[model samples]
Structure formats: structure tokens, C-alpha cells
Target chain A: MANYLKLYPIPEDYRFHRGGQISQGLLAYETWGTLNEDQSNALLILTGLSADSHAARHGEHDTAGWWDYMIGPGKAIDTDQWFVICASSLGSCKGSTGPCSPNPKTGQPYRFDFPDLCLEDIANTSVLLCQSLGIEQLQAVIGPSMGGMSALALILNHKNYTRHLVHIASGMASPPFSTAIRSLQREAILKDENFNQGYYSATNWPEEGMKFARKIGMLSYRSAKEWNDRFPRSLKKVPQHPFGIEFPVESYLEHHANQFIHKFDPISYLYLSRAMDWFNGHQYGTPRGANPLNDISLHSALVVGAETDLLFPVDLQRELHHLLLDSGVDSELIVTDSIQGHDAFLVDQQTFSQLVGDYLSASAV
Target chain B: MANYLKLYPIPEDYRFHRGGQISQGLLAYETWGTLNEDQSNALLILTGLSADSHAARHGEHDTAGWWDYMIGPGKAIDTDQWFVICASSLGSCKGSTGPCSPNPKTGQPYRFDFPDLCLEDIANTSVLLCQSLGIEQLQAVIGPSMGGMSALALILNHKNYTRHLVHIASGMASPPFSTAIRSLQREAILKDENFNQGYYSATNWPEEGMKFARKIGMLSYRSAKEWNDRFPRSLKKVPQHPFGIEFPVESYLEHHANQFIHKFDPISYLYLSRAMDWFNGHQYGTPRGANPLNDISLHSALVVGAETDLLFPVDLQRELHHLLLDSGVDSELIVTDSIQGHDAFLVDQQTFSQLVGDYLSASAV
Candidate 1:
């Protein structure tokens, strides 16, 4: 398949949200459809932690993207009706300048030397990418999961950037439970002997730690109902070893873990995962205790969540919906009865497409 | 504090439910109140996975036990009116013959050489202890969490052993979600380098693995609501390292994990945890495809579960209650609003005490 990724250079001495700066940075992005004459049809798409710029197929020669089913000619976030732009988040390894990217100073990967990353930084960089493309205002900005936090960051920080917002499966702040789980995931990597204080090489990669972290992620990503329906006490095979994969669920987790460990950079994963925990959109409020998202100026906002999502439960979305209303923004909340949990937005194509498509179509009027 | 523990040895040939036999087996136990001349007042207390025989204090000189709030005189179990006996489970390391015990055959810790232990084995061993104590029949058998499985095993296998049962925070079988969590916990221990195939020495103990496992356990034991109320996004301190404990929740988990890692035997944990997953009460059915508990001649059974329990959820208990009713047994299910989750039986003193106390008092008639 053809490579649809396009890199946009960040201007010199770009500052990070937390601290530090990169002299030279790049953001990989892709666009579908065309910018309108007035540049008002641009719909920016912010992504979850591990997603790339490829939201869907650009052409027959291009590979299918993560959100392939939700974005296309007649699909939700329809590219034909609106110019859609998806950027690989800042600090991600997916063709974006990150810990895995070569440091200009030493000609080596930044690794731990990379500045602390935050969702705010991810939002800011996407704004930069949009400006570079000569788009001043977007018709809508859609985000899901980690991207949902980044979308909130964008709207909270750059109030006039988008006329509408579509938030999916995220909370304004990471609850204590979510924070604890992410902290444990980070611990897995840090405790890995092969991690070597973030100096791990290609050969000495912390494969076990990455695999463990991904398994933990998989556990939280979906609901128990889904697993029960998929593999309740069904052993794929008799376990030969004491700690081996006994249940089909174990094998399912092992399969995903193995597939994920080698695909993502460990340090990048650590940074992005921590960024989610540190995110508190309420911090953007003018007064110390005010709801930060209360005053956002938007024509409309659509919040969607899964009934079974353990990570980003529906109550969080309900809170977000009320916050938007309290902030004087027109907002609506849609809860899907999808058993896939936090990951339902990604895999519950039919439900999400219907929700997003209906909202966007109505908003365009 | 007084030593409330009493050890009793198994007869010449003690066979495990799954397979294997031990020539010398030992059980540790503690009791409160007096046994009636006819043993009609005997009340056996089966424990959760990690509990010992000391369910409550024996006297002022004895150390306060895990269930001190629930098992004392005038408390939930009401020792004043019942001869209450609680025993360290057969596969546990609390003063019992377990993986940590010296094998009579090899004169060394059994470790991986220990036979596969099941909840049924734990049930059978508890029966032996009761029989040895000259208690031919019991007024009631109360079990919570892992003990609930053992309690079910007892009723299913030894139908006439007890007149009443109080099942708390467990199910007839481990649901796929609960199994997945436990399977991951075992993986953490097995992967620890210092685990050394269950031959880990005192100095080279798999502390990291055990700590990780316990942290995972703590995550499932309690409710997210409790964590949010207790810790929220409150940080204990500014982290000095990238992955240090920053959130109060992290430190809370760290405190519990550190305390647990050293106290519990890793192999014993592995064996007992797997037993919960492998437990299938239906296997005891006399005819194929019948309710295993259909013929149990119990006077009454009480099933209790927490609404917020992520591990052994209330639905499981509800299912068990329905199954018991279907089996011709008089049973009731009580769902508590306590936010402590699966660990509510241990910590929600007021709620559990009221429930257990009221039921036992009613059952005495």
C-alpha cells in the first residue's frame, strides 16, 4: 500500500506544555477530501494514544486505517461532506517526533531525555499543524479515548478553534482508579530488568514488560461481559505448564500482548499513558475551582460513551455533558449499550457510526 | 497476645480431591464460645483466600483477628450463642500443610512438588478437622470470598454436614472476568526472575512479583468509588522519579502491597488463587447435566454480595441464589450498598454484622 503519511515541520524553538523545548520537531498527518474555499469545512480528528494519522483509506492503493469503518465517503465523519484531517499525536512514535525520534543534538533517540509530554502539548501541536495547513477555524473536532482529552485541551485552550466538538469515551480528569492502573502499567516497564533505565537497545528490549503492560491495558479496555461471551472457561488447550495459557481468555490476552509489545515504543507508551493520568481539564478554569470547560464557545458538542466501559464509564460522559451545558455550550450525551467497554468506540462501529453520523448531519444544518 | 492456633494432623492416608495423597497432613484452627454436649451449637467459619484461623480475638490477651469486628461475642457470628470454629485452609500457609510446609517425604518445603490443591480439598480437610473436634454436625458454616467456594463445595459434597450456610462475596464458579484477573496475578509471580521455579530462597524472594500480584489484588478487592472518595486525584507527594508513587491511591496500594508481599507465601497464593478458578460445583452432580446442589438438605442458606464488587459481582451471587432455589434449597440473596467491593465482607463491619447477625439468629430457631 502507498504511504499516505505526510510530515509537517514544527517551527524553531517549539516549547512543550510541561517544560523544555525541541529545536526541530515534526508532526505526521494525513488529510481526506478537500479544504473548502472558505476553509470552514475542515474537521480535525484527534486520536487515542496508539493511533496514527491514517484514520481511513486515502485511496485503493492506501492501507486501511484504524477508523476505517467510521470515516469514508458516506460514513460518519464523512470525508466527502467535510475535509477530515487526522494527525498522529505529539510524543507518539507513529511518524511523530517523540522519545523514539532522533535528537538533533546527539543524533540519537531522545529516550528519557525527551521532555515530559502532556495532553495539552498534544492539543497545541495539532493546532500548529492546522495553522500550517492554513485552516483558521474548524467546522468540528472529533476525538476518542486519549484523543478525547486532547480535544478537550484544544477547546479549553483554543476556544475559537472549533465550532463543534465530538467527545468519546473520556473523562475530564483521571479518577483515582484509572490513575492507579496506569501507575502500575508504568511500574511494569520501569521494573523490567531489560529496560536498563530506559537505555534498552533493539536486542535488549523490555519485551516482557511491554507485553505485561499491554495485557493490563487489554484487561481494562474491554468489559468482562465481552470476555465471558467470548471465552467463558473455554480452554483453548490443556495447559502444559503451571503458569501457561490455560483458558482461551489467557490466550486471547497473550495474543494481543505479543502483537502490541514490539509494535509500540516503550518510552513513548510510558509518556502517553502518564499524560492521561495527569490530565485535568478542570485546571483550565479561570478561577481556582471553576469548571474549566464551562465557558467554551461552541455551536454544539456531542459526548458519547459505552454503558459497559470500565475505564471511561458513562457517568464521566454524563458529567461532561452537564459541564458543557453548565458552560452554556449546546451539548448532548449518547450512551451506547455496547459490551466492548472503553474500547467500544473503536470496535462498536455500527453504534458509533450511527451516533456520530446523526450528530454531524444535524449540526451541519 | 495469646496463641489461639491449634494444630491437628490428618490420618495416615489423606487424598487430595484432584489427585495425590499425603501421609502426614496438618490443620490449624481456633475457636470461640463453647461446644454444646451434642455439638449442635458448632458453627464452622470458612475463610477467604489469605485469612488464618484467628477469625476474631479469643480473649483480651489474644491479638485482634481479621474478622474481629464480625466474629466476637454479640458481634455478627455472635460467639455467645454459637460454638464458632475457623480453620486455616488446607492449601494455605497459615499454620497448615501447604506449599511452604516441609514435605514429610523430602524433608523440604513442598513448593512446586506440592499436589494441586482445590476448594474441595479445603472443604474435605475442614470436615476432617470438625470430625476430629468431635463435632459430627454443625449449626451453620459461614464463608466469604474464597471461603464461599469452599462452603459451596462442602454443601455439594457433604450434604448433611451443616444445617445452615452463609455465603459471602463468591459464586458457584469464577466468572471469566474474575478468572482473567487471577490468571494475570499468577503470571506476575511466575514471571518474576527470583521466583526461580518456586525454589526462591528467603534472601532471593520474588518480592517484586509478589508486590505486583498484591497490588493487582488490591485493585480488584475494593471499589473505584471508595478510591475516589478516599484519594481522588490527591497526590501524596511530588514524584522524584518518573514512575514514583505520586497519587495517594498509589501509596495506599503500595502500603497494602508491601505489607502483603512478605506475609503471604507466593506458591500458596498461586495454588489457592487457581483453586477459585477451577472450582465448579456442578461437577459434583450425581447425574450428568443436573444442578449439583439440588439435593442438599440444608435448612437455610444466606448469600451476600456487594454492589460494587468487580471480582465476585452481585450478579454471580444472585445467580447462585436462583440456582439454590432451583435445587430445592431455601436460600436468600442480600446485595449490600457498601462501596468496599469484594472486600466489603471484611471491612464493611456494620453492614455485614447486621446481615450475618440477623440471619444466624433467625436460623437458630
Candidate 2:
């Protein structure tokens, strides 16, 4: 890996789906390992809701990767054997051109002026990032949750852009329930006084609203079975604040929500959540009942799902797998029994690794 | 049936389990139909989470009931043949003596000064109400959700209080996940600026926070199958506000939350939800592997549950049924296949009514 963080410019006349354009924009990205001389061993990794491009340990300290369990020297998607690139999704606050980014024309932050984004723009931006690095995809693209939606958009639209796709716990589009929950989260932020109609300065954050949204998001990410198994109904032996955490699960949600508020931007979350809701493979001219993989038969894909995931049901993954097979594409579905729900991809790393690793290595041949 | 909403006095020394006691308190109740000559055919009806004593209509109008589907002349628990009583739980805001009720000594609302209540208190208060009505034994005690908890408490403590028991979509104790979600809801309310340590004026509600809690509660009450089935990912043709709803499911939750806020009292909700968490049937001298129905061998019980319920899994209801049978009680269990989750007891009225009605009539004969 040559650089820990890299920035690239977008076209001056670039426009997004919802009628707004940034004359000039910069996207921040991070990469690991070396691209082969022929530029044929590059793997692209897309992220979930609020992660940045730092996908693994950067320097001396054992800094954890979001997917650190599955990506190292001899790990599942071995960084030693394959060059991996991760770009911050467009409209994210993590060193990317977003609502928080300064406007080139007005010499101030875009704030509420940022364009309404869609799933396609996120997919296209990642493609543009790969092109800027002079890399024609050879290895694969891996994504989970919203990232999987991006992977679906990328491969289904670009066809031969990648050789393999690893979609975990995601579907072609956000279903009604998922979209509705996200809408509630956005409403929480919008209704917050500190949000100030997305005009709050860098120091004045919508902390309360973002924290509220994260609490809801955490519950949706995991299963009730898992929570019941992990926590108990008894109150804590020792109390902290006046309003004590009577149950362990409540404490768990509170801790995660607090941690998330420190990192995620309310505006970025609003845009990204909406983008996820708007995703659908059928919308891209691949009519209903037809496979998104029908036009790209050469790409072999691995779809992994958790049986306990209420958000993205295992049946949807099975549906996609069969659709790909019927279209003559080499596709396999792995439905694992896990209480971790949609989060099984991250928690049950060993199983996810073995299935994804074997498929990636086999397809690389 | 006498008074539509009658208030009863509690003894000054009536202390709850958690040591806080109102020197003097009142409980409000309502009833329907005539008690049989011997008062042996009186049916006691308990409610779910936050319902009042009005289980059905009181007058000659098409005025609806929450359980309006299954309780009427020639209906499930046919009011024509039996008397029915619905009492507001001890901590409810509807007509019950709750936190909002004035402190007899201080002439002010109890607020946080109210006792830390338990399911037992709620159950015992109903018994006191019955004693006041000159009823000794009941034909049946039917309850759903939290009401089921109260029924369990009543039968376990007062073994011969009822001739029959009907428990629906509830268990002996609140599971860890349900308690955790409830604890979070409490936190959301308390953390609100308007909540003011549960001292807010009745007119000035913690509207936003309570609405947020209700949204979370509604999601927990129903299953993912119901949500996805009820709504689709289509935005309205004409948008109303900047952040218009992208799915009908959002509108449904918003509407429900609005409705709930208007009727429910937040302070009472806090006490009742906590009381639900503290409910553990085994703690009341019923040891492990010991059925609460042990001494009531003459009582026949019906335990009904929903296969899709993530909150109160059907296995708990099945375990209780088996426990009753082991105690030489004529008990039966009904597990309905429905996507409505714990709410199946409310939605699938025909199935529920037929099963309950058959058992009651057979036991009567």
C-alpha cells in the first residue's frame, strides 16, 4: 500500500439524480496492497451505513478494521494476495464531498444545498473512483447491507466491470418496512432543534437526534432472539445516572447510540438512508421476474444471508441465487443459522469467510 | 352491570411490593350484562398494553370496542349469557388511580412519588374490585399480553379465584428483549426536555419523545411480515412536506403514534412498563418445574399464542400448557399461524373466539 488516504476529483459538470450539480468535487479513498503490473488483481469494498475508507489497520497500532476479522495477510479476502480499494460513499461526511463539504461556487459549506442522492449515484461514484485509479476490475466486489445494494447496482449496470460479486444480507431494493424505518430516523433528525434545517455549523451537531436514530438502527440490525439470549431482565447491580439503565439491552443500545453520534453526520445519514430506499435492480430496465445477472452470465456471485434477519429475509437471497442460476451465471447461496440477524455477516466471520474465500479463490482461477 | 365508570377506595395501608404506598387510592372499573342468580357466571376480561376498562359498548350505539370483534350478543363470550367486567390496571391513566391521580395527603399528582408497581398489584386490585362487587369466584379470567401476566399472577396467588383461565400471547415473565425495548422507551421519555422528570403539566406533553417511543413500540408489537404485507415502496403522487413519506408503512406508524399520545399518560406508561418487566411467576413460591396451576387442578385453562410472535414466542405458551397438564388440570394450547405476531390474539378474532368459546361452554357443562 502506497498511501493510507487518497483524494480524486470529479468532473466539473457532474450532476446527481436530484437536479443539483457540483462544479468540481473531491472523493477520499484508501487502498491496501499493490495492484499487479497488469492491474488485474484489484478488489473493491463498499461499506455499510456510516463506515469510512479505513478498512484495516493503517500503521503500528492494532487499529481495527470494520471487517478486520476477514481481511489480512492470510485472511479471507487476503490483502497480501489482492489489492483492495475502499472509497467513502459520495454524500458522506468522512472526507468526501457532501453537505458538510465547502461549496466551490459560494465558498461555504453546501449544507442543505447538497443534491438529493440515489443508489445509482453511489454506485457510479465508486466506478469513477476505480477508473481514476486506472484499474479495470479483475478480482471482485464485496459489500454488506447498503454496500450490497451498491454492489448490485454496480454489476447489474456495468455488466463486465467485475468478475465476481459477494452480496451479504442485502437485496435488490429496500423493502417497505426497511424504508419506513429509515424514514422515521430521518424525521427524528429533521425535527431536532439543533439540526436547524441542516444549517448547523461544524461545532453545533444534532447529537440527540443522531443518537436516537442510531438506537433504532441498532435494534433493526440485530434479532430479538439474539437480544433475549444475550441480556437479562434484572437491573444493574450498581446505578450510574439518576435515570439508570434497568436492563442490559437498554444499556447496550444506549452505548452504541452514544458512540455512533460522535462519528456520523445527521445530514449524511439522511441522504444515504434515502439512497438505500430508492435502490431497485428492476428500475434499471431489467423488467420484473427477470434476473439482474441475465445480461452478465460470466460473473460468478456468492450470496450469503442469515435465517434470523427480518430486515433482509433469507428467502430473498435464495430467490436471487436461483435467478442467477437460471440465467446461466455461476451463483451460490449460503443461508447460515445465526441469531445475529443481518449483522451475521460481521459477527459470524468464520462462516462468512470460508464461503466467500472459497468462492473468490475458485473464481480467481 | 351497574356503573359505567365507578371509582373504588383502597385502604390507606395498602402497600405495594416496592414499599411505596398511597395512604388512600382509588381504582376505576366498568362492567356489562347481568350477573347470574348465583353470580357464578361472571367473566373477568383483562386487556393488553394500554387499554381502558371499556372492553365493549355501554349503550345502544354502534360504538366500537378494542375487542369489538368477539364480544357481543351471540358472539364468542356471548354477553347474553354471562356478565363481563373490565377494570383499568392500577397504574393506567384512563380511569384508574395512577400517577396522575392526586395524592390524598398532598393534593398533588404522585408523579415519580408513586409506588414501583408490579403485575401482582394490578391483579390483586382486580380481586379487590370483585370483592367490592360481592363476587366470590369467577367463571373465567381471560387476558392477553400484559393482561395475561395479571391473570397468571391472580391464579398463581389465589388458586381458587376463577373456575377457568384463558391466556393469550403472553408468558409468565417479560423476556429480556421486550423489557430492554420498554426500558429504552422510558429513557426516551425521561430524556426529553418537556418530560421534566415526569413533572410536566398535563396540557404540555412530551409529544415528540412519546411519539418516538410509540413508533418503536408499534414496530415491536407487530412482525416484519405484517409491515411488508401492509405497505409497498411507493411514494404518494403528490408530496405534502419536504420530507414526505416514501412508504405507506411510515404513515401508518405516524398515525398510530399520534393516536396513542392523545390517550396515554407517559408517567403511567413508565410505571406499567416497568411493572411488566418485574413480573416473574416463579418468584411467587412457584419453583422451577412447578406449575402455577398446581393447586387449581379443577380449573381448565386455554393458552393461545402466535407462531410469528417474536416478543412472546409460542414455545413459552406451549410450556405453560404442558405445565398445567402435568398438574392434572384440563388444559389446552392453541398456536395460530399468523403474521400478526404477538398481536395475532387481536387480529385473528374468529379463530380465537371459536377456540375460547368451545372451551368455556364445555367446561360450563
Q: Which portions of model 2 miss their true places by more than 4 Å? A: A1-3, A58-62, A237-243, A285-293, B1-3, B58-62, B237-244, B285-298, B322-329
True contacts kept of each: 0.57, 0.46
Q: Would you estimate the TM-scores of all the predictions?
A: 0.98, 0.93
Candidate 1's C-alpha runs over 4 A off are: B286-288
Query: Per-residue lDDT for A53 in model 1?
Result: 90
The residue-by-residue lDDT of candidate 2 on A1-365, one tens digit each, is 23567887877777786677886787789887889888888999988878778777755565777888788778888888889988888889888788778888899877768887876777778888888888876578888888988888888767788888888998877776677668778877887788998787658888888888887777678887787678754556454643477567777887888888868778888889878877877555467655666787456888889998877887668877887788787888889998899899889887888987898788889
Error of 1 at A320 (Å): 1.0
Q: Please, what is the whole-model Cα lDDT of each candidate in the order they appear?
A: 0.88, 0.80
Q: What is the lDDT of residue A174 in candidate 2?
A: 74
TM-score of 2: 0.93
lDDT digits (tens) for residues A101-215 of candidate 1: 8999999999889999999999999999999989999999999999998999999889989999999999798888888788888888888889888898889999999989888
Q: Can you give the DockQ of every candidate in the order shown?
A: 0.70, 0.53
CAPRI class of candidate 1: medium
TM-score of predicted chain B versus true chain B for each candidate:
0.97, 0.93
Separately for all candidates shown, the number of backbone clashes (residues 3 or more apart, or on different chains) is 1, 0
